[model samples]
Target: MQGLMQDWPLTVDKILDHAKAWHGGREIVSRSVEGPIVRTTYAEIHERAKRVSNALLGLGILPGDRVATLAWNTGRHIEAWYGIMGMGAVCHTLNPRLFAEQLVYIINHADDRIIITDLTFVPVLASIRDQIPGVKHIIVLSDEAHLDGSLPGALAYETLVENASADISWGGFDENTAAGLCYTSGTTGNPKGVLYSHRSNFLHTLVTMGSDVLGIKATDTVLPVVPMFHANAWGLTFSAPAVGAKLVMPGPKLDGASVHELLETEGVTFSAAVPTVWQMLLTHLRTSKGTLSTLKRVVIGGSAVPEAIVRGFRDEYGVDVTHAWGMTETSPLGTQATPNYAISQMDAEQQLQFKLKQGRAPLGIELKLVDDDDKPLPHDGTTFGRLKVAGPFVVGEYFRAEGGKILDQDGFFDTGDVATLDEHGVMQITDRAKDVIKSGGEWISSIEIENIAAGHPKAELAAVIGVVHPKWDERPLLLVKLKTGEAATKDEFLQFLDGKIAKWWMPDDVVFVDEIPLGATGKIDKKLIRERMKDYVLPPAAGVASGAVALAAPPEPKIYAPEPEPEPVVEPGHEDDAWLHWTPDAAQSVDRSRREAPAAPADHVEAPADAQLPFRGR
Candidate 1:
C-alpha cells in the first residue's frame, strides 16, 4: 500500500515562490550591459517574472512552447528564465559564443518561438534573423529607449514587462513537463539539445545543494561567472534561490581586470567558472598583486584545471578550489571534487591530491567504469576505462534522438570520457576516449601529457594531439601558448618532463603558437588545431622534438623501454570533435615488441567586466 504523502508537483516555480515568501529580501545584483549595476530582490524578481509570463502570453506564447534566450548573466536574464519556465514554457538558452551558422541551426531545430536577448546580442540576432524564421518575437532585454533601430520590430523587455499585468497563475501542469533546453557545445558532429524536465531539474537542484555537492548556503554570496547559457549556469540559477543564496551576475565583460574588480568590490564569497577565466584572473592578480579578500571558494570546470591554477588560488590567494566534472547531458553537475569527510580530515597539501580528482558521485548519482564489450572494469585507480554515469539528473536520450539509444540496457549513459575511479570512489578523467593516442596496441592519455606540459613556468596554455608516426602508429604532438613575455626552448620543456612522465608518452614535437583559441564553451579547440596543423609532419623518431626552432640536436630516441605488456581493451568511442568536423587518423599495425618506458611520477568566462555586480544579503 502506498503511504500518504503530499502530491505537490516539484515544479521549478515553487523554488521562486518559496524564495519570494521566505527570503523576499535576498538580492540578485547584476552588471548590466548598459553601464550601471542593477539590483533587484527576489520579491521584485518574482513579481517581474510574473509580468514576463503575462507579456509572453499576450504575444501568443503557450505552455510547452520554446522561448530562446541569448543573453549574458544578469537579473533581467534570470527573470526571463523564470518567466518562461514558470508558465510551463520551455526556456532554451542559446550560447552567443557559438557561430552564426550554429545559432541558425539550433534555433531552427528547436523551433524557438521567442528570442529574448540582451542588447549585446541584438546585432547577432539581427544577422541571423532571416535564417531563423521560426522565432516570432525578438524581445530585447533593455529599456525601450535603448533601441538603436538596428533590429526592426524588436520589443523592449523592460517596457513589455512593465506594461503587462502579473495577475496570472503558474504551474498547473505535470512536474515532468519540459522546463529547459541546453544544447551541447557540439564538440562532435552537431549540437544536440538536452531537454530537462521540471522534475529532473528540481531534483538536480536539490542534489546540488547537498554538503558534498555545491554546498551553497543561504549566507553565501554567489558569483556565477559561468554564462547562464552554460548548462543553466551549472544549475546555480535554481539552486541559489532554492537555498536563498544571493547571486551576482556578471554582465558581458569577462576579462581579468573586470572580474578581479568585482570580486574585491562586491565581497563575493563564492564563485564558479572555467579554467581559462581563472588563468586570466590569476595573471591579472600576479601582475597587479590583486586579492580576493571576500572570495572564499571557487568551482573550476569546462576543462581540466591546470596545477598552477589550483596552486595560485589556494596557495597564493588563500581560497578553496574545487575541480568539477560534468556535461550538459547530466544537468551539468555530474561530480564535484569536494572532499568527503574521510579525505577532508587530511592536511591541505594531502587533501589537494584527492581534490584534484573528480570526487565521488553524490547521493543520487552512481558511477561505473567499463571496458570494451560493455564489461565491468575494476576501480583500482590506475586502470582507465570508459566512464558511465547513471543518475536521476542524467539525460536518458538526446532531443530528437540525434544519437539514438545512448543508454545501455542497465540505464547507464556513456560519458565519452576515459577515467580512473579509485577504490575510494574518486574519479579522475584521463582523456576523451576518442582523443586517447593509441601506440603499439596501448593507449596514451593526451590530457596527462598536456597537464604536465602546462605546469612549466613559461607555459601558459597547452594541448596534446596525436599525430601519425611511422612505427608507433600515433605519437603525441605538444602545442604551447607561452605566458606573455616568457620564452623557453624545447629542450627545457622536454628536460622538465624527462623524469616526470613515461618516456614513451613524450611528444614527438613541440610547436609554440602565439594563441590557442577556446571553443564556445572555453575548451581547447582541438578540431581547429588539428585543421591548422594538418600539414605538419613528425620529425624522424631518432631526432629530438621539433620546436619552433630546432634549439639543439639532442640525443637520439634512447629512452629505456619497459616490459612488453598486453594491449588495453578499448573500443572506438564517440567522435572526438570540437567546433568543426574532424576525421581521426586510423591506427596502424602495432609493433608489440616495443614497450613504453615508464618514469617517475610527476606533480600536477562570459561573465561581466567592471560588470561585476556585487551582492549582499538583507
Candidate 2:
C-alpha cells in the first residue's frame, strides 16, 4: 500500500517554492559588483529566478543545454544558478582563476550556448573570444555604464530579465536529468567535469541539512567563502535555501579585512573556507584583537585543518570548528566533524583530537578502506589504506568521457587518498596514494610531517616529499616557506619534530624558499618540487659530524618499466595476483637523532560493498 503523501520529485523549483512560502521574509544579502551590500528577501529572489528562467527560454535555451556562468557569489549569480537549473539546463560555473587556454577549452567543450558573466571578466573573455566556438549569446550581469564599448552584441542582464515574463512554466522532467556541471581543480592534468543530476543534488542538500553536517537552519546566516565554481561551493547553494537559511555572499574581495568586515556587518553565524583563509583571518584577528561574538562556528576543509586553527577558534574566539572531508565527486562533503554523545564531555584537548579526525560519514554516504588486493581494511585507525567512497551524490563517471567508464566493477570511486579510521570511526588521512613515502618496507605519511612542520611558529607552509636517498629507498626532504619576519634555525625546526614523529621520518634537510608553489586548485604542488630538486644530492652521515663538504652526482636507480601486456582487471569480489616492487636507496641514512615517523597501521583496514575509505588530506 502506498502512503498518502505526495510523490513529487525534489527540484530547484520545490526548494524555491518552500523558501518563498515559509521563509519569504528571510534575507538573502550580497555585495553588488559596484561595491555595496544589497539586501533582498527569498520571495523577491524566487520571482527573479523565474524571470531569469523565462528570459533563458525567450533566448531559445532548451532542456539539457549547458548555460555557463562566470560571475562571483552574488544575488545575480544565485539567480543564474537556480534559473538555469530550474529550466533543466545544466549550469556550468566557470572559474575565473583558471588559465585563458583552459577557460577556452572548457567553454568550447561544454558547448555552452549562453554565458552570464560579470564585467570584471570581460577583458579576459575578450582575449579568448575567437577561440570559443560553442558560446553564442553573452549576457553581462551589469548595467550599460559598466559595459565597455569593445564588447559587441552583448545584452545587459537587467534588460533581458526586465522584459521576461515571470509565469514561465517548468515542464515536468525526470529528476535524474543533469542540473549542474563542475570541473576539477586540474592539479595533475586537464580538468575533468562532474555532472550532477537533480536527484543527486537534492539528496546532497538533505544530507547537508542534517544536524551532524552543515546543520543549516532558517535562522542561520551562511557565508560560503568557497567559490561556486568549486564543487558547487561544497553543495551549500541548495542547503542554504532548503532550510531557509539567510545567505551572505561576498563578491570579489576575499581578503581577511574585507571578509571580516562582511562577517561582522552581516552578523554571520556560520561560514566555511579553506585553512589558508582561516589562517589569514586568525592573524588579522590577533592583530586587531576584535571579537567575532556573533560568529558561532566555521567549517574548514578543501585542505587539512591544523590543530592550531581548531584550537584558536574554540579557545580564543569561542567558535567551534568542524574539520570536514570530501571531494569534487562526492558533492563536496563526505564527512563532518561532529562528535558523538560519548565524547561530547571529554577534555577540550581530547575532544579536539577527536574533532581533528574526518568525523563520520554524513547521512546516505558510505566510507571504507581497501587494500591493494581489494580486500576490506579494519576501522582501527591504525592501518592506513586507500579510500573508496560511494553515495547518491558521488559521481559514477566523468561527463562526456569514455561513455561513463570511470567506476570500478564494485561501483566505488577511488579518492586517491590513503587514510585510516580510528576506533571512534573518525577518519584520518595519511597521504595521497601516490605521495605515501615507502621506506624499506614501511609507509611514511608525508601529511603528518607537513602538518607538524606547519605548526611551527616560524613556518608559514610546508611540504614533505620522498626525495632520492641512496640508503632508505626514499627519504623525506622538507621544503618550507617561512612566515614573514620569523626566523627559524634548521636545527631548532628539526628538534621540534623530535618527539612528534619517528626518527626515520625526520626530514634529511630543510630547504628555505621564497614561496611554496601552489596548484590551480590551491593545493601544494609537490610535482613541481620533485622536478626542481631532481638533481639534489644528500650529504653523507660522516660529513655531517666532520663539517666536511663532499658533493657527488646523485645515483641513478633502475626505473620500473611496465609490461606491454596489461594485467587482467579484477572484479570487486575477485582476487588477482599482482607483485609490487620495493627497494631501499643506498645513499641516504636514517637520522636516529631525529623523530621516528608514525606508522599508519590502519592503512590495512577495509570496508563492505558500500563502505568508504578512511583517507585524509584531500
Candidate 3:
C-alpha cells in the first residue's frame, strides 16, 4: 500500500506557470538578431506564450503535431518553446550550423507542420521551402515590418501573439507525451531524433537545479553560450525558468568579443559552452586585460575540457570550471564535475585532478561500465570499458524507432563512450568506443593523448588517429595545428611527453597541419581525420619494421604505464615533499623548459581557409 499523494502530472508547462506565479518579475534579457536587446519578465513571457499556444491551435496544430523552430537563444525563441510544448505539441529544434541538405532531411523526417524561426534564418528556410513539403506555414520571429518579401506568405511572429487570446488551458494530457525533438549531429550516419517527453524534461530540469548539478539559484544570472539547438542548450532554457534565475541569451554572435560584452554588461554569474568557445573568451580576456569579476562558474562540455582552460579559469581568473559529460540522448546531463565533500579534503592539486574527471552521477542517474562481451566491469578507475547509463532522462529508443532496440535487457542504454569510474564515484571518459586505438591487443586512449598535446603552449589544436601497423595492428598518428605565430618540432613534442605519459603510448609520427577538422558540435572529427590519413605510413622505429608485430599479449591493465622511475624517498616533515607534489607552477615550468629549445622548424602544409570537409560525430 502506497501513501496517498496528489496525482499532478509533471508537464513542462507547470515549470513556466510556477515561475510566473512566484517569480513573475524576474528578468529575461536576449540579444536580438534584429539589432536590439529585448527584455521581458516571466509574467509577460507567460502571457505571450499562452497567446502563442492559441495562435498555433488556430493554425490547426494538434496536440501531437511537431512544430519546428530554427532560431537562437532569444526571448522570442524561449516563448516559442513554451508555447509549442504547453499546448502538447512537440517542439523540434533545428540546428542552423548543419548543412542545408541536412536541414531538409531533418525537416522531412520530423514532418513538421509550422516552423517558427528567427529573422537570420529566414533566407535559409526560404531556400529549402520547396523541398520540405510538410511545412504548412512559416512564422518569422520578428515584427511584421521585418518580414522579407523573399519569404513568401510567411506570418510575422509578433502579429500571431498580438491577435490571439491569452486565456488558454494547458496540460490536460499524459505527462509522458512527447514534448521536444533534438537530433544528434550525425557524425556516423544520418541524424537520428531523440524525442523527449514532458515527464523527462521536467525531471531533468529538477535534477540540473540541484546543488551538485548545475547548481542554479534564483540570485544567479545565467548565460548559456551553448546554442539552444544543442541538446536544449544543455537544458538551461528550462532550468533557468524553473529556478527563476535571470537569463541572458546571446543570439547569433557567439564570438569572443560579443560574449565578453554580454558577460560584463549583463552581470552574468554562470555560463556554459564548449572548450573552443571558452578558448576564444580566454584569449580575449588575456589580450584585453578583462576580468571575470562577476562570473562565478562555467560548465564546459560537448567536448573534453582542456587542462589549460581549467587552469586558466581556476588559477588565473578565480572562476570555477565544471567539466560536464553528456549527449543529446541523455537529456544532455548525465554527469557533471562538481566538487564534493570528499574532494574538499584533498590538496589543491589533488582536487584539481579529481575535478578534471567527470564528476559522480547525481541522485537520479545510474552509471556503469562493461567490457566487450557485455559483462559488468569493476569501478576500479583503471579498467576502462563501454559506458552505460540509465535514468529518468536517458532515452530508451530513438524517434520513430529509427535504430530499433537501444537499451539492454536490464534497461541501461549504451552511451557509445568508453570510460572508467573510480571508487570515489568519479567517471572519466577515456575515448569513444570506435576511436580507441588497439595496439598489440591493448587499448590506447586518443582523448588522453590529444588532451596532453593540446595542453602544450604552441599547439593550437591536436587530434590522434590510429593508423595501420603490421606488427602492432594499429599505431597512433599525432596531428597538430600550431598557434598563429608559434612553431614546434616533432621531437620537441615527443620529448615533452617523456615523463608525462608512458613511452609505449607515444605517437608513432607527428604531422603538422594548418587546421584540424571540427565537427558540427565543435568536436574533433576523427572519422574525417582517418579518411584523410588512410594512406599515411609510419616511420621505422629502433628495431621493429614499420609493419612488424611487436607483442602478442596485452599488458597488465593500467590507464597509463608507471613513471620510468619512482620519486626519491623523503624524510618525515621534509621540505622536498612540497616540491615533489604536482603543482601548477611545476606544470608550467615543464612547459617552459620544453619551449626553451624549440627553434627547429618542421614541414607543414596549409589547407585553404574554406576547405569543404565532411562533418562527423559529436
Candidate 4:
C-alpha cells in the first residue's frame, strides 16, 4: 500500500525559494567580467532571477524551451541559470573553451532558442554567427555602458532584467520536466548531451550536500573555480544556495594569483577545482610567498591528483585535498574521496592510500566491476575490470540517444573506465578503456606510470601512451613537461620511478617538452598528445639501462586510433531494441546520462608523500 505523504515534487526552483526565504542576507560575491567585484544577496538574486524569467518570457521563451548560456561563474551567470530553470525552461550551459565548430555543433544540437553569454564570448559567437542557425537571440551578460556595438542587435542582460517585470509565477510543471543540458567534452568522438530533469538534479544536490560529499555549511564561504558550464560547476551552483553558504564566483581569471586573491579577499573557507588549477595556485604561492589564511579544504578532480598536490596542500598549507571522480554524467558526483569511519581510523599513511583512490559512492548510487564478457568481478583490490554505475542521478541514456543503448541487460551503464575495487569499497581507476597499453601480451597501466612520473620534484606535468616496439606488442612512452627553469635528465626521471611501479610497466623513453596540452575540462588530453608525439621513436634499449639508443621504426602500433565507431546507431527495423523515445511522459519516468580516467598500483601501498613543498609555512 502507498503510504500517506505530502507528494511535494522536488523541483530545483524551490532551492532558490528556500534560500531567499531563510537566507536572504547571504552574500553572493562575483568578480565581474568587466572589472570590479559585484555583490548581491540571495533575496536580491532571487528577485533578479524572476525578472530574468519574465524577460525570457517577453523574448518568447516558453516552458521546456532551451535557453543557452555561454558565460563563466559569476553572479549574473547564476541569475541566468536560475531564471531559465525556475521558469521550466532548460538551461543549456555552453563550454567557452570548446572550439568554434564544437560550440556550433552543441548549440545547434541543443536547438538553443536564445543565448545568454558573457562579453568575452561575443567574438566567439560572432565568429560562429553563420554556423549556429538555431540561435535566435544573443543576450550579453553586461550593462549599457559596457556595450560597444561590436555585435549589433545584441541585447544587454542587465537592461533586460531591469526592464522586465518580476510578477510571473514559476515551476508549475512536473518535477521531472527537463531543467538543464550539459554535454561531454567529446575527447574521442562528437560530444553527446546529458539532459537533466528537475527531480534528478534536485536529488543530486541533496546527495552531494551530504556530510561525506560537499558537506558545506551555511557559515562557509565557497569558491567554485570550476566554471558553471562544466557539469553545473560540479553542482556547486545549487548546493551553495541550498545550504545557505556564501558563494565566491571566480569569473574568468582562473590564474593562481587571481584565485588566491579571491580566496583571501573573500575569506573563502572551501573551494573546488581541477588539479591543474590547484597546481597553479600552489605555484603562485610558492613564487610569490603567499599563504592561504582562511582556506580549509580543496576538492580536486577532472583528472587524477598527483601526490605532489596532495602533499603541497595538506603538509604545506594545512589544507585537505579531497580527490573526486565523476563525468558530465552521474550528475558529476559519482564518487568523492571523503573519509569514512574505517578509513578515518587508519594511520595517516594508510589513509593517504585510500584517499588517492576514487573513494566509494554515497547512498543513491551503486558501482560495479565487470570483466570483458559483462560478468561481475570481485572487489579484491587487484583485478581490473570495466566500471559500471546505476543510480537516479546516472544517465539512463544519452540525450537524443546519440550513443545508442549504453545500458546493459541489468540497466547498468558502462562508464568506459577500467578500475579495481578494494574490499573497503574503495575504487581506483587504472586507465581509460581506450588508454590501457598492451605490452608483451600484458596490460600496462599508463595512468599509474604517469602518476608516479608526475610526482617527480622537477616535473610539472606528465602523460604516458603506448608506442610501437619490435620486441613487445606495444611499450609505454613517458612525456614530461618540467617545471619552469627546472631541468632533468632522462635517467633522473626514469630513476625516480624505480621500485615505485612494476618493472614491466616502466616507460621505455622519456621525452621532455615545453608544455603539455590540457583539454577544455582541464584533463591531460592524451588524444592530442599522441598526435603531437607521432614522430618520436622509442630507444631500443629502453627500460633496460640509462642512455638507451633510438630503435628502428616498426609499423606504428594500432593503439590510440581515433576512437573507432564510438557512435553505434540502431537499424530502422530494430525499433524494439532501440533506446526509449523521449516524450514528456517518457522523460518523467527516465532520469540519469553517461561517462573519466585515474591512476595508482594495485599490490603496492604508498607511504605519506614528502612534506617538503616549495611553498612557505602553513
Candidate 5:
C-alpha cells in the first residue's frame, strides 16, 4: 500500500514564488553589461519575470517553444530564464564563446524562435541572424538608449517587458514539461542537446541545496563566474533562487580584476567557477597584493582542480576549495568534494590529499566503475575503470534523441571518464577514456601527470599527451605553458617529478608552448593539442630514433569477454532500481596513492552475487 501525500507538482515557478513570498527583500545584484551595477530584489524580479512571460506570450511563444538567450550572467538574463521556463517554454542558452559556425549550427538545431541577447553579443548574433531562419525576433536585453540600430527590427527587452501585463499565470502544466535546453561543447563532433525537464531541474536544485552537495543557504552570497549557458552555470541558477540566497552576477567582465572587484564589493561568501578563472583570480590577487576576506568557500570544476590552486586558496586566502566533477549529461552535478566525517578527521596534509580527489557522489546520484568488458571493478581506490552514473537528473537520452540509445541497458550512462571509486564512496577522475595513454599494454593516466606538472610554480598551464615511442609503443609527452616572466628547463621539471611519480610513468620529453589551447568550456583541448603536435619529433632520449632505452613491461591487465546486457528496471517509489548492485565482497582494503603513479595492486577482490541494497548517501 502506498502512503498518501499531497499532489503538489514540483514546477520551477514555485521556487520563484516561494522566494518572492519569503525573501522578497533579498538582493540580486548584477554587474550589467551596460557599465553599471544593477540591484533588484526577489519581489521585483518575480514581477519582472511575470511580465517577461506575458511578453513572450505576446510574441507568439507557446508551450514547449524554444526561446534562446545568448546573454551574460546578469539580472536581465535571470529574468529571461525564469520567464521562459515558468511559462512552459524551453530556455535554450547559447554560449557566446563558441565558434560562430557552431553557434549558428546550435541555434538552427534547437530551432529557437526568439533570441534574447545582451548588447555585447549583438554583433555576433547579427552576423548569423540571416543564417537562422527560425529566429523570428531579436530581443536586445537593453533599453532603447543602448540600441544603435545595427540590427533592423530588433526589439528592446525593457520595452517589451514594460508593455506586458504582470497578471499572467504560470505552472498550469505537468512538472515533466521541458524547461531548458543546453548543447554540449561539441569537442569531439557536433554538439548534442541535453533537454532538461522542470522535474529534473527542480529535483537537482533540491539535491544541490542539501548539506552534502553545494549546501547553499539563504545567508550565503553566490558568485557564479561560470556562464549561465554552461550547464546552467553548474545549476547555480536554480539552487540559489530555491534557497533564497543572494546572487551576484559577474556579467561579461570575467577578468581577474573585474571578478575580484565584484566579489569584494558585493561581499560574496560562496562562489563556483572553473579552475582557469580561479587561477586568474589568484594571479590578480598575488600581483595586486589583494585579499579575499569576504570569500569563504569556492567550488572548482569543469576541469580537475590543480593542487596549487587548492593550496593557494586554502593556505593563502584561507578559503576552502571543493573540487567538483560533472558533465553536461548529469545535470552537471555528479559529485562534489565536500569533506565527509572520515576525511574531516585527517590532518591538514591528508585532508588536502583527500580534497584533491573528485570526492564522493552526493545523494540522488549513483556511481560505479567498470572494465573494458563492462565487468564491475572493485571500490579499492586503486583499480581505475570507466566511470558510469545513474540518477534522476541524469539524462537517459539526448535531446530529440540525437545520439540514439545513450544509456546502457542497465540504465547507467557511460561518462567517457576514467575514474576510481574508493570504499568511502569517493571518486577520482584519472583521465578521459580517449586521452588515457596505452604504454606497454598498461594504461597511464595523462591527467595524473598533467596535474602534477601543473602544480609547479613555473608552469602556467600544462597538458600531457601520448606520443609514439619505438620501444613502449606510446609515451607521455609533457607540454608546458610557462607563466609570464617564468622560465624552466625540461630537466628542472623532470627533477620536480622525480620522486612524485613512478620512474616508468615519467614523461619522455618536455616541450614549452607560448599558450595552451582551451576549449569553449575552459578545459585544455587535448584533441587540438594532439593535432598541433601530430608531426612533432621527440628528442633522442625518448628512444624514437634508437631503441636503446630498455624499460620493463608491466603485466597486461585481465581482459574479460563482453557479457549480455541487462534490461533497465524502472519501478515506482524505488529510485535505486537503476543503481548497480555492490556486494560486501566488492570492498577491498588497498592503500592506493592517487597522487603518484604506482604499480597496480596485486590482489583483486571480485564482486560476489548481485545483492542490491537501498541507495544511501554518505
Candidate 6:
C-alpha cells in the first residue's frame, strides 16, 4: 500500500502563504538602502508580494520569464524575491560584486526581461543598461525623491505595487518550474547559472531549520551578512520567513563598525556569512573590546572557517559556530558540523577540530566520497575523495543549457569538493580537488595549511595555493594578508607554522601582499592569485625525468589507484545480484526530505533586545 502523504506540489508562494496565515505577525527588519531600520510584518510582506506578483503579470511577464533583482539585502529586495517566483517567473539575482562586463553577460545570458533595483545601484545599472538588449522594464525600488526625471524607461517600485491588486490567484505553478537563478562567482571562467526549482527551494528551507543546522525560529532576529545576490543569501531570505524569523538586513553598511552596531542593536540571534565577513567582525569586536552574550548561533560557510575563528567564537563569546558545505547547485546548504555526542565528549580543542569539519549531511542530502573514477570510498574519515550528493534541494542542471545533463548515471551531483567522511558520517572538505597540491606523489591540503597559518598571532588571513615545483610536481606558496597595522616577519610566521603542520606540508615560501582579491561571491579568488604569480620559479624534481620543474601528468589513464572490491556477502534473501558501481557500500538510501528540518542547536539562548551585550537577541 502507498502512503497517504503523496507527492504534493510545492512553490515559493506557498512558503509565503504559510507565513502569512500562521506567522503573519513576525517581523522582517532591514537597514533600508536609504539608511534606517525599516520594519514590516510577514503579513505585510505577503500582501506586498501579492501586489508585486499582480504587477508583474500586468507587465506581461509570462511563466519562466526572468525578472532580475539588482539590490541589496532589504525589505524591498525580499518582496521582489517572492513576487517574481510567485508569478511562476524565474527570479535571477544579479551579484553586484561581479565586474560590470560579467554583470552584462549574466543579464543578457539569462535574457532578463525586467529588472528591479535599489536607489544606490541605479548608477551601476544605468552604466550597463544599454548593453543588455532584452531588458524591457527597469523598476527602481524607491520613491520619487531619488528620481531626478533622469533614467528613461525606469519605473518606481511603489508605482507598480500601488496600481496592482493584492488579491491575485496562486496554485497554478508546478513544483518543477524554475523559481530562481544564481550564478557561481566566475573566478575560473564565466559565471554559470544554477537554476533552482520550487520544490528544491522549499525543501532547502526545511533542512535549514534543523536545530543543529541553521536552526531559525519565529522569535529570532536573523541577519544574513551574505548578499542576497549570492545563493539567495544562503537561502536565509526564504528560510527566515518560512519559520517566521525576523530578518535584519544590513544594507550598504557592511563595514565592521556598521555590522557590529546593527547586530548589537537589533538583537540578532542567528547570523550567517562567509569567513571574510566574520574575520572583519571579529577584528572589530576584539579591537573595540566588545562583549557578545545573547548571540546564540552562527552558520559559517562559503570557504572553510579557520580553526582560530571556531575557537574564538566558542571560547571567547560562547557563540556556537556551525560549519556548512554546499554550492550554488545545492540551494547552498549541504553538510553541517553539529558536534554529535561522541565529539562533544572530547576536550575543547578536539571538539573545535570536529566543529571545523563540514559535518554530516542534512536530512535530505545523500553524501558520498568517490575516487577519481567515480567509485565510492569508505566513511572512515581517512580516505579523501571527491564529494558528490543528490537531494530534493540540490540542482540537477544549469539554466537552459543544451543536453544539460549535470548528474551522473544514478543521479548524484559532483560538488567538486575533495573531502573525507568519518565513521559518524561527518564530511570534512580538505580542499577543492583541483586545488589539492600533489607534492612528491602525495597530496597536501592547502586548506589545512592556510587554516593553521591563520592561527598565527600576527596573521589576519592566509591563502595557500599550489605553485609550480620542478621535483615535487606542485608545492604550496603561502600568501599572507596581514590585518590593518599588523606586522609579522617571514621568519617568525614560518616558525609559527613549524610544529603545527607536517614538514612536507609547510609552504616553500611566504609572500605578504597588500590584500587578497575577492571573487564576486566574497570568497578568495585563487584563480587570480595563480594567474598573478604564474611566472615564479620552481625547485627541481627529486627523481622525475629532469631536475627542472616537472609537472605531474593530469589525472589520466594511470593516475589513480583502484580500491579493492568488497568481498561478496551472502544476504539472507538474495546474493545473486551482481555488484554494480564500485562503492564502499551500496548507495545509502538517498532521502530528499532531510534538507527541510530545522538544524539549529537547541542551546541557542535569547535575551531581551535592549541588552548591553554586543550579541544579544531582541
Highest-scoring model, TM-score: 1
The residue pairs found clashing in candidate 1 are: 187-577, 253-608, 253-609
Query: Is candidate 1 or 6 superior in TM-score?
Result: 1
For candidate 1, write residues 160-278 as lDDT tens digits. 99899998898989999999998876767788988999999999999989878889999999999887788888889999999899999888767788888888877899898887788
In order, the Cα lDDT scores of the candidates are 0.78, 0.73, 0.79, 0.78, 0.79, 0.73
Please state the error at residue 515 of candidate 3 in Å: 1.3
After superposition, the stretches of candidate 2 with alpha carbons farther than 4 Å from their true spots are: 1-5, 402-404, 542-618
Per-residue accuracy of model 5 over 1-618 as CA lDDT, tens digit each: 987998888899999999999999999999888888999998999999999999999999999999999888898999999999999999998866566777889999999999999988788777888899999999999999989988888999999999999998899889899999988777667889989899999998998898888889999999988778877888888899888999999886777888899999999999988777888889999999999979998988877878999999999999999888888787778888777898888899988987888888888899989999999999998898999999999888988789799888799999888989888888888888899998999889898899899999888878899999888889998877677676566777788888988899899987765445565666776776676567766677542321111011111211111122233332344333211111221111121112232122110111000000000000
TM-scores for candidates 1 onward, in order: 0.88, 0.86, 0.87, 0.88, 0.87, 0.85
Candidate 1, which segments miss by more than 4 Å at Cα? 541-618
Clashes of 4: 4
Q: Model 3 Cα displacement at 427 (Å)?
A: 0.7
Candidate 4 Cα errors over 4 Å, as ranges: 543-618
How accurate locally is residue 180 in candidate 2, as Cα lDDT from 0 to 100?
A: 92
Q: Please provide the root mean square deviation of candidate 1 (C-alpha atoms, Å).
A: 11.6
TM-score of 5: 0.87
Q: Give me the displacement of residue 238 in model 6, in angstroms.
A: 1.9
In terms of lDDT, the poorest run of 10 residues in model 5 is 609-618
Local error of candidate 3 at residue 391 (angstroms): 1.1
Compose the digit string of candidate 2's lDDT tens values, residues 22-120: 989998899887787889988988888999999999899999999999877888888888889988999998866555676777888788999998877
Better of 1 and 4 by lDDT: 1
